[model samples]
Target: MNQPASAIEILDTTLRDGEQTHGVSFSPAEKTNIGKALLERVRVDRIEVASARVSRGEIEAVSGIIDWARGAGLADRVEVLGFVDHGKSVDWILKSGGRVINLLAKGSEKHCRHQLGKTLGEHLNDLRANIELAREKGLAVNLYLEDWSNGYRDSRGFVYRLMDGLADTGVGHFMLPDTLGVMTPEQVTAAMTDMIRRFPHLKFDFHPHNDYGLATANVIAAVQAGAAAVHCTINCLGERAGNASLAEVAVNLRDQLGLNPRIDETHLVQVGELVEHFSGKRTAHNAPIVGEDVFTQTAGIHADGDHKASLYHTRLSPERFARSRRYALGKLAGKASLLKNLERLDISLSEENQHKVLQRVIELGDSKKAITSDDLPFIIAEVLEGKDYTHVELLSCTVTSSLDLQSTASIRVRLQDEVLTAAGSGNGGFDAFTGALAKILKKKGLALPRLVDFEVRIPKGGRSDALTECIITWACETGEVRTRGVHYNQVFAAINATLRVLNLQIQGSLQQSRSIDPTA
Candidate 1:
């Protein structure tokens, strides 16, 4: 492999090749959003957004992207895929306001001979014609060798001759694609090195598919072998196993190979999510760099190591990508792991209390799945506040949820020495209970926290009597707050969690008053 270069260019094809994933289609607005995100936010070098003449909607999407790109001074960074069909593709591209055209040409001898039924010389004439037409139309041009890997392997001379012939054509980039994703890293290195050695003046970009699942590795090899750029799709969206993931390839170029890729690492996850949302592709939680669970520490040893000595830490810290590391609370959590979470929550516990909490966490982990930080206050309240801290208590809650009927709740609460009862109804039992609680809290001049998100889950292999954990995220005046409640009944679990939050707020209010007037 050649010595590393300063930086490699990234061409994102999430809107073009990525949209080809089976059952994935983006609306015109979605296309514009992704295109803008790739160029403006993620800061990829270039983006191939659509194929020429695909559809009216596609044209509309391209027009929208071009309009934004022009206003943002990024019009030149956008590209469209075209074919060597005389001037039709170029005309289509010009109509869509595309500035760069990636012209698709036959790369493999088999494709050229069998698919196109044309001689190599005849194909070159058409390619040259198309390039000249695009240039005449004021469009920059790149060439996509649809199966360049196979072409180099089977007919090296044919591949060289094509480059030798077109070296003077003033094409902006020669995009070499492992269209079938069949090349190993070794093959990619050797072929790309040979291509660079022979055509030293030509700009080359490597595009790898994931059929062999070595697309990222092959991309690294190609870059090391002196390819100027690499093409990728977000969330690895493409046909078959997909293309190399833009997130994986980009980070590898930076972190592993020590080359500058002009992507904003912080925006990778955001762009991946946008593509996933619009494309309807579910990203694997364990996917490198952009997966949901990639930043979560599951093992107690790993968490403890990080806390003690930063042992498990690497340069690939989550903070670098605008994400926070998570020490998952589960069966695998140690005291150190629990400490990390408590420190984050700004809650301190005695050593003995920490041990008790750790044991409860482990027990719950064995039975259930995720337990968030919000659950800790309830556990602490149960263990420590047996009598004190009962600012407001739910004396009784009776909810009726039945088929084809609105859920109703009758709740009685004790605030200090007084008892208040209220009845309310909603489409769900939890909503009904919250409504009743709101009515009673209104009488006490206390308002409920704004519910932001509610998530519920049961234990693994949950039996009929398994405990239900209800986690609620609240938007408080200070910030966001999360609380958890586990109970046999789901609605009761939510109520228990809500009560903990209410008590916390009430206690906080009392502390504030006390601080203002110590004499009182």
Candidate 2:
């Protein structure tokens, strides 16, 4: 039988170290919201909310959090970062009703010599005095050995000397930070094991940064080396690269390491979305666990493997994190992927029709176009219409726009060769086009859905002919749906997306009415 992995505690520091990211600052209200969400929703074991005496705003933010945590009866679980400054930091912590402080201390001799201009003995004495003062002031202290990794590498003897001096200072924990994020997993294991051997009685916490994109890996190493807690931030928000990401760390610890953390995996993506919105930093589409495309398989072979036996997947299933796997259609899509896409759209194609549609889809994909499920009917209508079936078609559209000039669009559409044209004008060309479309639909006694949202994405590598992808969402009496369009011009993309939505709506209404009364 295999031995089970050890459990490690999680200490999230998004509000403190994470806020240190350049050009990122959370308002007091924002900090309070994030604190509540992290504690009550995400359920990390502890949260380092802020630093002491940073600013009046920070003080208020920590104070508010302390009040909230107190009401929730979790006051002790909240912590604040402080420094050894003759009890000034202690005073700030006490004033803010913060009971726990991660006291900042020099871990390396160079920091002591250059930053404080103090000898090893002098620094130890100062720390002792500060610890005694903190104890007298009723503050629980956790020592942060700033730059401890560098200390272990450069001056191991001095590092041990400082730890030995403060070993019995009634400190609650020793937080070893990779302050410069320079340690590899091997180094972390070696240094952490040495520290554990030297101070067997002291509880150790590990804080890692992401300057090298190895913070999560280092966190795992720390746990393996017997760290009691590891610090993380939501979305890896911190100075420079970032700190270890909470979602990645939590899931990895649970699934890969077989460690149990009291985190609700289902809420991981929701929390990431909330933070991304509040921080005004959009999460990249490819971000692991919480990105739009992480669960979407775009390659046909991968989709086929997934359909067969989930052969292309890892242990991280999308459903485990409240997400569903998606099959994307493009040049890379195979027959299995196309069948899956058709299944999602509730459309059945004959063997011959499937090949024709697949060919067209591949041709479009070769041009770097993205086809959505809503585009299936239009493709079928164009390919199979008049030959094997009668279907709806857009006959012609006239659009005009000029600055301070009358913008107009006249559209003529044909349903089984019955033609209808409508004209309208508005402030912009697309707007006028939509107005004319609505007019035509109303005159033909067709009910049009309302457009709820519109978004345009301009591809990178700017050029006049660069492809623009437009997505539109529509809401109707029956339901809501989304459609995507691509074109060289932004306006053209929008127009295409709008037309797709309209086309889908017409097809859906026709099918529903036919289903209600087949003879009619």
Candidate 3:
């Protein structure tokens, strides 16, 4: 019988199998950073850092990871994948300072007979020789039965023979991979259960691929059927459809199966982002746990439920992952959604004005998707035209740009009663505008807030003339604020967004002064 609630080990293969992702490669420094984060911060049980003898770069990456892991008293937890080239792979691993080697062996008869052109006996001899050499050198060994899923399905005898030959070899973990990601959850459960029942003493780990989008689900099945550990990759970076997502697998194991995985929940998204940045792969906005929009409430009703009584809450709270819940404001926004966003911004409005703002937001959503909360002030200012949010405004501006040449911006702006002219140059038009704007603000003994994130996009399927929307995030004393601007030209859009930030800053200062002064 399978245990109901036991600890499951997580073996992250992002640096090894994950590098097989198309056009994705991590440098030695990147690998070291990721490895440190995984073992020190995210706290996965084990990490497979690289493949042996791949390159001089691979050696450097593995050696760096091993050096750190050893100093941290986690040398045995770091693993490197190696081939069945007798002593060569073992020697390479030792050269890289790795203590554990995940040896790749043909699991399926077809792979053995066709790929390696070796019979079962010959392959067993090679695997035993490699295992012996690893044991003699004081290196831990884990065997990967590559394509174990099909091997068990097509020819159980071959799998039985392979396991029989290596059953007493003192291997740490026998990792079974669904190499083509062709197993359904039912199949995984049956195979994993049978393997456990048959072997009884050997530790088995299930490695799943996401070609069928069943990697996480298959992990659940494998765990329920007694897999001691499961393999995953950060951000699901792997060949074909990728491997099981480390975040998804860890969360599901805890929530669904009552299993404890050695994962630090708060750092899941942090590590995912690190991997995303280094791998140059953009995770989908809706990807679970680590996606940008995963914690955002898009539906108005959902926000309402959350606002009234936390009806829409779950154990998967964003706070658990060091993130905050966001209510998206768009055409689907309602009174509750507006209230939620208003609450976040510490802004209070009359019911009538709130209604007005909601209507405008919906109207904008008809053309745009979701208006960021940073954009709310602009919408509110426009909806209540009586409000004085525009304490500063740009009177006129001209920007010029040419390829391979610095861009220049000449701007004339009215700061209260004074008109100022400033010119500046930069690598791009927006940069030039900021340079010029900085000079103007410097005159007033104020500096613009540091820019944090800038994103520009257009309506999906829109033409070249389609309006460009630029949302700029800035670091302020309170925290962060985002301002949005829309224009046909992308540069102008960014400039408009920047102008909005300045107006808001000036307006806030005036309001603060008024509150402090007895007479003005």
* lDDT of every predicted structure (CA atoms): 0.88, 0.85, 0.92
Task: Pull out the clashing pairs in model 1.
Answer: none
What total of clashing residue pairs does each candidate reach? 0, 0, 0
Better of 1 and 2 by TM-score: 2
Residues 1-520 of candidate 1: C-alpha lDDT, one tens digit per residue: 5545456889999899998899999999999999999998899999999999999999999999999999999999999999988899999989988899999988888789999999889999999999999999999999988898999999988888788778898899999999999999999988998888888888999999999899999998998888888999999999999999999998888888888888899999988988887887889889999998998888899998999899988988899889999888889888888888899877889998998888888987998656766666655666676443687889988999999999999999997688999999998999999999999899878988999979787877999899998888899876898887889999999998898888878877876798899875
Off by over 4 Å in 1: 1-5, 385-443, 446-448, 451-473, 482-520
Q: Is candidate 1 or candidate 2 better by lDDT?
A: 1
TM-score of 1: 0.84
Model 2 misplaced regions, further than 4 Å: 1-6, 386-454, 463-465, 473-480, 487-492
2 or 3: which has the higher TM-score? Answer: 3
lDDT of 3: 0.92
Q: TM-scores across all candidates?
A: 0.84, 0.86, 0.95
lDDT of 3 by residue, 115-146 (tens): 99999999999999999999999899999999
Error of 2 at 298 (Å): 2.9
List the candidate numbers ranked by lDDT, top first: 3, 1, 2
User: Cα miss at 91, model 2 (Å)?
Assistant: 2.6
